[model samples]
Target: MERFYARERMGVQGSWSRHSAARVASAQALRGRDRLRAALSAMGFRLQ
Candidate 1:
């Protein structure tokens, strides 16, 4: 259980770093709808 928690924490941190990197790279390249979709996907949500 402890190991699971630790791994989950690390995963969250890694994803946060990647998310920031992606945001910076995509900030200018994505348009409004695409930006919204990206934001939703980043938050682990999907648009239907």
Candidate 2:
């Protein structure tokens, strides 16, 4: 039973790490998009 619990904890930790990584990636993508938009605006390009 203790081993089972340990395995479960490990699985939970793995999922948490994955979630954190995904969040960071999403944030970086959003920042990149914002930067692109700003650049386009500065160039006076309209998105239509």
Candidate 3:
């Protein structure tokens, strides 16, 4: 019914927000890893 649709819309919006936040966090982590790799290379470091 109408109530079900209303609640479903809210749930979808909440889930979308959660997914967006996770994506942002993941991108930041990836950038951090890239920076770490660059730093390690600059310092002549490598992992076997």
Task: Write one digit per residue (lDDT tens) for candidate 3, span 1-48.
Answer: 445547777443445556556645765656576477778878999855
Question: Per-residue lDDT of 1-48 in model 2, one digit per residue for the tens?
Answer: 445547777443445556556655865656576477779988999876
Model 1: per-residue Cα lDDT over 1-48, one tens digit each: 445547777443444556566656764744464567778889999778
When 2 and 3 are scored with lDDT, the better candidate is 2
Candidate 2 ranges beyond 4 A from true positions: 1-25
How well does candidate 2 match the true structure in TM-score terms?
0.31
lDDT of 1 at 30: 44
Backbone N/Cα/C clashes per model: 0, 0, 0
What are the C-alpha RMSDs, in order, of all predicted structures? 9.3, 10.5, 10.5
lDDT of 2 at 19: 51
**Cα-lDDT of candidate 3:** 0.62
* Winner by TM-score: 2
lDDT of 1 at 25: 74
Arranged by TM-score, best first: 2, 3, 1
Model 1 reaches what TM-score against the true structure?
A: 0.27
Clashing pairs in 2: none
Model 3: residues >4 Å from true position, as ranges?
Answer: 1-25
